[model samples]
Target: MSITRLSDLADKAACPRLVVKVGSSLLVGPEGVRRSWLGELVEELAAARARGQDVIVVSSGAIALGAARLGLEKGGRGSLADAQAAAAVGQIALSSLWAEFFGTQGYPAAQLLLTLEDLEDRRRYLNATATLTRLLDAGAVPVINENDSVATQEIRFGDNDRLAARVAQAARASAVLLLSDVDGLYDRDPRDPAARLLPLVEGVTPEIHAMASGTSGSGMGSGGMTSKLQAAQIAELAGISLAIINGTYATPIARALATGTGTLFLPRRKAAARKAWLGGRLRLKGTLRVDPGAEAALTRGSSLLAKGIVGVEGSFERGDPVAIAGAEGRIVAHGLAEYDSRECARIMGHHTSAHADLLGYAPRSAVVHRDQLVLK
Candidate 1:
């Protein structure tokens, strides 16, 4: 839970499953796609795969690469239309390049473009996780990036760093690596030459934050040390370990996982696949009323029961997160409903033993199974 311990975990992570998010700055430097760096990344990823690790890459640079290829001198700085157009073209070319690169190495890479809505919506989020799981199981690497073209503000992933964190939570990855231009976070701007790199950040205290100056330059990339830290915070909350390191360095991805060097953010508490999935999103669909005793039991980490349910409101089927409301109509927890709205209403206020007779259905578990619940 302490950043002090992050490095040790980084060193020992053996991290059977990993997620690496690459920034645009690392992809297209002052020149073009840093072929050497890209090669090192690919080789390292391949090596990890060979070592029995499943890896997913959240890549940025479709727009940058597309604009460069299209000879668009003014890209993102230009009109929105130009930016979207560049992203569309770049996404196609960029994905093709990745497919070809990984294919030659005998590992296939699949491109997945997600908008912010995918993570905000619980069902859609699960679908995305399922898709990625299938890819990892099939021994294919999933390359995720924001859908820059079609996505507007509502569904946009503001930055790839944020997207990367969400992806880590979605996949329940034990570790999340953020590859950028900066080597690591420094107490002051490293450019001053007098600044110093803080090796271990146990927690982003007020003093530590004061040390974080302006956005550290990332050349063509939107994220800086500050943004990476924010991503780390988000990833950490869901129990995903995070690292920010220099992407240009040879084998940066694999090396960081090997604890070569980086700023590591440790997970406060690692959640299981189901808990991680449920806890990551708090959006509620409906409400479930519980008695005072039921509230106590559920809050104490006990499973839900029909005996606890006083009522059900709104419309949501099985597996949907519904707010667990107390007698006073205050929400105490959010959990996946075991039955549909009508079914839950019928089973409400009844004891668990009577589920089969009243509902004429052989219920397997409680009203809201503990595994499906996310306590507030």
Candidate 2:
């Protein structure tokens, strides 16, 4: 992997799809929601959308808003029930605020509350991906937040910074902007006079992780620099660039995109997280033997069509990882299967036009989409 660091942030030209994470400290306060700040932020996002960019916001303010409404302390030390109740109450207000603000800019905002479990389950992951894609295609901004009201301790992400990274992975975003309390990562405690911000991080290493200390935000927010570092690592591995910037000022997103006023974490590649996982980590549950024409098509970066599939082995369902073999049973690639084993058996050696007649319903055109395949 290339460890190429940058002295500045990657410009908007480099990121067509962006995820911006807003912390509670920036959105809520002792009184209530910071409407002016949120309005400004929405304006910046609207400018991005006008430029033909897909923008998603991962916001964290539900619990804080709820706590204030219920006369509870910020960053509650109460039982999980208290927090969940706060979340349940605050979620409506939070979503409403987002809708109200974005609506003023003539942008429709959609809410998506997800738990870590949703991303971990393969079927749900794909479904979430599809939903996000559809929302973006419809020219709406998705406002995502952790499902704090329903999440247990075991399933809770507890912080929006890491959640933003995971959301970037799911959305195939090109960059993630973590707009929090601090401007960027510092060499030491930011309170120290001698502390200096690191502008660009090529890779997240142990030494880099050591620089981050305890949480640095207001009591309303849960994540500290530690969670941000963890987020950077996640973004790096998934080939998505991430940046830490303070959103205390007006038009911070525009300034950061233009002037690189933050610490930017570079990705290992320009590829999406799905491709990276398919290429390396996932275990294969089955195999497909394809004809020589399909083997050549794969080498040329084409999708695997049913007409090229000669044999299917092992019992696997749709979205399961499977290996593709060519001549002499040599493995050529691995990918997520679009159809189950029985479906593959029925559709093998047939044209895509014949799929509906054989399967009783029209399915995906390719057995393995090029985006989901990793060539060996």
Candidate 3:
């Protein structure tokens, strides 16, 4: 569906669940937090909530706020420790501000700080999903952010854009609004006189991704057009639509939702809940290599048994997402592992009966239950 104007969005049915990601540059200023802009945004979100829509906000600005408080320069500077310290101090301020803003609008808000582990581990992922779902069900808005205070470069989401996409997938949101400095995608840099804005994106193809260039001009934000495109791709695969919109104006969230004044990236197709979860995984804890028989069984909707397993690669705990590969070393499916890597190695080629004697405890029979597996 091509959405070139805000009227296009108004003609369509209202989105049931929405995820809005606000950039640090939009929320933070050199003087301090932009209260007026934030209040407007909160009012817009509250209106959506009043209309019976679930709204979640993935906000950036902790580090920016912390930097401002410490009188440090923004952008890529200082050590990991310094960044962590800033995040620790800034997150408190950011959360408090959100609470106050949402409170004034008569909307309850909760803060969620997540790390990579929260999404990769099946147990934690489910827990987070349940919490978010409960909050939405209770008419509360969830204000989410990366747990930058504890996350390192290796474990962090790197940008709120991708984290918002992940959050959308987890929450099963119908749409995502990326509120940033840029209004929408362009054939070329929007700063150039010849550049043309792309109002609608059917998919994030290689050619489309190629159009993105440069970082977010704001020294406070980490993501640029490239990251937003990456986020759109992720959202598309999860059966969610994403839009990049200019958030400098008042009521940006309401405007984007009502008028579609942004580059709307449509989902490729609808995905089942299990398929969405499988496709949206950003990290795989390990890989389980199986024989031809096991691969065939998996294709036929059978559980991954230890008897047909050939190898276990990498270290992972129980309930962690793992890649299931076939004899040809191609990933055939993704599933939550019932056993750890070490246990799987020991039980490989063994029957379910032997699991008790080998592991000293009788756990589940299958390495990965059929219900938990999603084929690639």
Ranking by lDDT: 3, 2, 1
TM-score winner between 2 and 3, please give it. 3
Q: How close is candidate 3 to the true structure, as a TM-score?
A: 0.76
Could you estimate the TM-score for every candidate?
A: 0.70, 0.71, 0.76
lDDT of 2 by residue, 345-375 (tens): 9999999999999999977979999988876
Ranking by TM-score: 3, 2, 1
Identify the runs in model 2 with alpha carbons over 4 angstroms from their true place. 1-12, 74-77, 270-376
Cα lDDT, all candidates: 0.76, 0.83, 0.84
Q: Give the per-residue lDDT digits (tens) of candidate 1, residues 1-376.
A: 2334333333334466778888887788767888877877888778777767788999988889878877776645365666677889889977887897788789999999998778877689899989999999998999998888887755576678878888988887777877877767788777888987665665444476566654637557666666677676557657777777777778776565466466776655555666655554535668888899999998788998988888888999887778888888866666788888898899888877888998887986887888888654
Q: Which pairs of residues clash in candidate 2, taking residues 3 or more apart in a chain or in different chains?
A: 215-224
RMSD in order of candidates: 7.1, 9.8, 5.3
Q: Per-residue lDDT tens digits of candidate 3, residues 226-324?
A: 999878877877778888888999888666656656788887665676666675676788999999999999989899999999999999999888999
